[model samples]
Target: MDDMSENAKSEQYQEKTGRESNPIGVAAVILLLCICFLIDARVGFGALIGAAAGFFAWSLLKDNGTRKEENADDRVAFLDTTVLQHNFPLPQNMPIPYAVLDIRGHILMYNEKFAKEFPNMELILPVVEQLKKAGIGKHAVVVVEEKHYDAMLNQCEVVEENGAVGNVLNMTLVDISKQYELEERLDRNETVIGMLFLDNYEDVMDSLAEDRQPLLSAIVDRKLTQFAADANGVMRKLQMDRYILLLSKGDLETLKEKKFDIMNTIREINVGEHIPVTMSMGVGIGGGSLEDAMQSAKAALDLALGRGGDQVLIKEGEKYLFYGAKAGEVGRNGRIRARVKADALWELMGASSSIMVMGHRNGDLDSLGSSMGICAIARAMGKKCRIVMNEVSTGIKCISEQMAQDEYYQTAFMKEKDALKEMDDKTLVIVVDTHRTSMVEGPSVLEAAKKIVVFDHHRKSAQDFIEQAVLLYHEPYASSTSELITEMIQHIGKRIKLRSIEADALLAGITVDTKNFAVKTGAITFESAGFLRRNGADSIRVRMLFQNDIDSYKAKATAVRDAELYLGSMALSVCPANRENSTLTAAQAADDLMNVTGVKASFVCCKVDDVVYVSARSFGDVNVQRIMEKLGGGGHFTVSGAQLKDCSAEEAKERVRSAIDEYLKEETT
Candidate 1:
């Protein structure tokens, strides 16, 4: 046993680089085993016992090394309060709110500046406990109009007193007075200035007895005056039905916070006798100057009324925020002086030796008819005039046939290549009907022509051609481009013998666009139709122009059968494939479907190749123009169109449905 112990110790010393000797316990065991071995030959077991004792000693050394590594922190006390007190001291007088607390959520000290600034709550230990219990210690909790404060004491640091460990919390409190003040000022200054106008005010007044009419005027004025007072704003009765308001900017935020209660306020206006009342409001704000803001506000109001009444439109920069759009349309009255002025300028167009009248791609009746009228005027001025159109849709194929019968107009449909051949610096291109740059017949023609003129009646859209043209006449409230051009003809030299073909073309445009004077027909619409009748535009020929092939009629019927209604007022018809003019045919069929049971508005969609086209219609009971405009399209109050790229018929239908739902929700809630 003694020999075995000695050998084991020697090996252990070698493996450990001779660092230490074997333990005394293993040596004593080895000595006892050696005595036992000396007594008996079987005592050779002493070597085994000594080896086992040596192994146990080695295991104890390994465990001791591991324990030292794991419990190293016990040797160096981490909590040192004296070092912290000297390094981190609470500020004596900090502007921002600040606090100091000891561990256990006890407030040790607080800056008076915090209390002076936010005196809502007395900062004490009790308050700290209350705040901790509330579980909003780290949140920005404040009573808006009332005074309140939330203190967060989350700052934690280790501290030691006489070698005893503890924690000290140092936190900074913010008065937040200036922040609340600025927010209050911002809220107070956020004004939503809007203008309200009575629809067809003159017509309504004229319909009343002379004595009662003045009473209605006074009644409207007094109600508006009271309403403005309620909003803490100044009201101006600019016209019989038009009222201008100067509202408080702060009230605007409050109104928005109340979810825009102006809608409900309008519904509550009591007209003298029992009468249904509705108004179109335009709102604008956030302009650097008040005057510019008011101008924007007025423009928005005009658009709202122009689109039909009983709606609120808020204009911000170039985009619009629309609301409360569910209202029936009343008749629109607009001035034609602008169109007259545009036509008078045409005579002065003699500055250029020649003129070209162009329409948008796939020229419709209104575009073609309006361009023909302008062409006649240019020729009368002794300047060579040409009509530039790339394609005529199948719906207007008959009208194109009639235009070809006239030699004067036959030379008008000049292709882009042919038109470029005749193009020069002295040429003026007159764009008719459509105003969007994307919808123009040929963008290259516009780029080539330095001098341009535009005449359109569709509502303004994102891409307007007005800025590019030398002269622009855009009347959104007008019935059609033909109607606008007819008014312009009155100013041009003695209304020239309206050629039978020219008259028919103009009448066809009015018929196709107005659905034979059924939609959006106003006093001027009737007046223009009467003049065309005198100029040899036979109604029989106009009706014949609308007749379509049997297959097209069948397609129209199919679209009608597939029509889907939305908002209890709109219908959608989708045609995925058709070689004919499916969009136009579907639009007509949708209009016819409106007479069925409960439909008030209609939309038709058709897909050609990869592009999808949508046509919107209203029975004067709803305004589909705003809905279509949201989908990147524009037209009159009752009719509009849009094109969607890379979309299936079903996807387009779903989008239109979402728009309808959003629009109705805006009007109702």
Candidate 2:
């Protein structure tokens, strides 16, 4: 049947089904329409009607065609999806290695192959981006983007059907969590490193003038930043002057290697005003964990500071490593603050009756002056105070003689046997200008006193007598012990009757410590000096106290003339004289020699009896404390000293030379 015949037949079938007729009736209607259109031209109109009737009769054919098209679309979709699923071209029965998931990461399908490979695996998509966002990206073996399906899906063949473009997305899942865990375990087993925040950064920077603080801070920050960068670690300023660094085990060795440069680097930063800024770095390596490393670093840092700043000290397994600090200068502070410590100190001291005041061996002006000042206060409190001395060096003879002339300021030069007899539970011992228990003039005095109070301006030491002292007033930044004592007297009252000789002694101490106001004299230093001046400390009288005997003056002049220059900055003077206090004389000569055209630092080595003593001074461009520390001594950056026992003066001089050479080598690069 043709088109008109087919439609008429479909129409006929519909009408016949409604009227309860069979296929014979439908065929008759189809024949009638076909005959009408074929017989006459006018009957073509009837053929049109017949065609419409045939169209209606054949509606099932149209439905069948629609169904065919729908089936084709479904087949095409299935083929596209299959291509993606089977992108790897593995055997038909091979298990897929990854779960098929939708865009939302939910699993849509899992092949038998995938099930076999990851039987217990969750159906999560386990994509790279998802892992990275969750901070577990380190375990990812491969990263695939949705757009790079052709590459990520193993470059499976493309199938073109109809006019649609489709992509294959085959993802492989690799479980490397075990590997990551193993690496983490290994890292834990390796050496761990930690850092110190280096407290009082502002205090260090403020040691420079107000206008110069920023410059110094920038210099310091830049060097530290660069060092952190070199270590392949991240360093951040946690606070104003505090920093936190995360370093790997491998990078810690670099820190140890560059230890010398670190000291040199810090000491090189200038503020355009005061001394150069330096740091005391403590490194802890090979700890059980990062926390232990941090604890060790803290301990090492305290050691450095206690020894005095401007050196690198490392603590590992109870062993210590010290580096840099060839200049041997302990920092000086002329500033003085009132001795009115926390109320707790007064209460602690008030609990005692008889008090003893003492100082380091061969007490200097500052030590004696501070003790005298304390004695006056003790007298005001109606307490019996005795100044203890091992032996007078004659350097402080005039002041000591005058104080002795006044019966109230009594001296206890009796042997230790006698001093111990007088000591009792009510005795309060005040140690001035020294912290080390071994350095005190009379160790028994400290051992005998029931309660000990320590006031010192020097840097701390490992041998500090902390447990013996109930109260400690140690300020490494202060200028002199005399200045601190002077401040305490002011708080007690001006009516404490400070004698002219006492005032002179205090001023001389300040002058000697500050090197005639050349370095380390802060605002508080001059203020203290001014206070002493007002209390009748005549400049001429103070100057008279510093004037040595004629022979001693000549020795000082000769020592300066024989000084040798090192690194265009440091001057070294070796004194072989048997002068009883040649160490002090040589140090004074070095200080005087610093005024020479290009001298930046001065070191004086002198032999006293069997011990070779070295005294160092600096313009803040060098770290002398580190040098002294290497010889088992410690002090501040601007002034430091060390004693070389059982070594000849020549051997000591050679050691000094070697230290200077090493220091110069570090600075050059």
Candidate 3:
């Protein structure tokens, strides 16, 4: 093993010297071995070993000499070179820009290409800091001279002869401006799906003269075709009153810039009819695929139709944008759907073990009346049912007391807490009057119930709807939820009878919501009232229910007396602060102001329990729903109310005025 180690060392020494094994050394060793063999054979072996040891020692000396020579050359190479001389060299003619930055992101050196691209180090300082934060072997995109570049950063060490090292970052930037532009162009050209449905098409056609019908249809088609052509889109007629549209995102942007004037253009076309034609459009963009885009378009179209048509709804991912929601919902031809919904409700009730009916918080006459009507239906269906209510307004206190005296209604009422305790999987919850979960009497009840149903007359909220509803009966054209319930009771059967007081309560609800059947009272509304009348609902009794106490009367009078007029046709009234029954007083004041000639809209603001409430009423020309929505409340186009928590009456009034101003501004624009 020792001989092999010596031989390996000798070979390494020869390699370092850049020379072959010495022939003179080998000849001396061979001659010594020959002399030992001639002198004595036994002693010759020992002499050979000694000679080999001496040759190994001589090879070690030669290896040391070669290493010393190399070290001397390395020292001489650095003797004339400074640390900066070794570090500072620029690739002046390189196409790719490059830079060197110290650990603190201060630029030490840069190539000419980098200097030309970013003449000021200040502009590149942020990029350098970002690259330092990203550490080494990572790329960052940065803009220079209005062009994009992908910069790769690398950390390197500069070693000196003294064994000291300094750290620096080397950045190489490659231009990516053209590639980014290409990607943007492709994105803009991606396809978007849209659906268009003619609003009130059947009604318009029925009203038009037969001879002019075809001409009007042709005109509409030609205009729609022209509209699509102008946007470089494709449109195909899907039905007599519906169209499917496919357009690029770029074309959609152009239409957006035009503010979708096709809606106005179609409305301007007249065919010897009092009602002009209108259309609703729903567009979907930024979906993952064509099928996904089409599904989004379908959802958007459903929203548009549900919002009374003559509008546009655009769906992009989870968000939505709306346009042209100025028109009121068109009256339907009949109440056929109400009968269908009534039968469905009856079936659902029969299958359930018990039913619980609820309404919005601070249960008003309308909400209470609707809840009672549904309870009456549940009783007729032979299902156990209870009305869930924890509080009653002062205005309905007398009626509630009267109902509590009756044997049938003695055990019919339950609080929200009690109702939740008794609930089971077979329990069905019928929510009435209000569809928003925030306004419900008890959201927990709605959340815990396995089967849910909704009956509401208010316009659907764009957000915050009853997502768990299995059956939704929402009719924006109806005057009141009580009216809807009355219709449903009639369809249930003649045998399912409402008590005289129940009838009166339902009739009072319709009267209050419709302002004594003077506003938003359609033929169906009156028919529903007639059904309640036949069941022994007396108008005198209903009127008696609305008769306010002395203090309420005085509060209402004061609110009317303090009326302020604005916008030439609107009246704003504010009730006294900290008054009893302030909500009812404000509503009465608003109704009274609406009676004044030339007062197209009326708003009454009042403070109640740390919250300011505004009761809004309009006379067809103004959309109170839009105004109220601006204040975070929603109802019908002509009647709506809002509650402002922790606000003064004066602040509430100002907010109402501001909402009115904004609404009018939007209308004009």
Clashes of each: 8, 29, 0
Structural RMSD, model 1? 8.6
lDDT tens digits, residue span 201-283, model 3: 87788888889889988999999999999999998998889999998998888887677889999999986854888899889
Q: Estimate each model's TM-score.
A: 0.71, 0.60, 0.77
Candidate 1, superposed: residue stretches over 4 Å from native: 1-178, 190-216, 237-243, 253-281, 305-312, 323-339, 415-427, 444-452, 461-471, 493-495, 565-569
C-alpha lDDT of all candidate models, in order:
0.71, 0.67, 0.84
Q: In model 3, which range of ten residues has the least summed lDDT?
A: 75-84
Q: How many backbone clashes does candidate 1 have?
A: 8
lDDT of 1 by residue, 313-343 (tens): 7787787776665544554555456556655
Q: Mind giving the per-residue lDDT tens digits that candidate 2 earns over 257-373?
A: 666476566666666655555666677766667788778877777666655455666777677776654443244342233445523345665677677788887678878888877
RMSD list, candidates in order = 8.6, 26.6, 13.3
User: Where in model 2 is the C-alpha error above 4 Å?
Assistant: 1-246, 257-281, 285-294, 304-313, 317-344, 412-415, 447-450, 462-468, 491-497, 566-570, 665-669
- Give the better candidate number (2 or 3) by TM-score: 3
Best candidate according to TM-score? 3
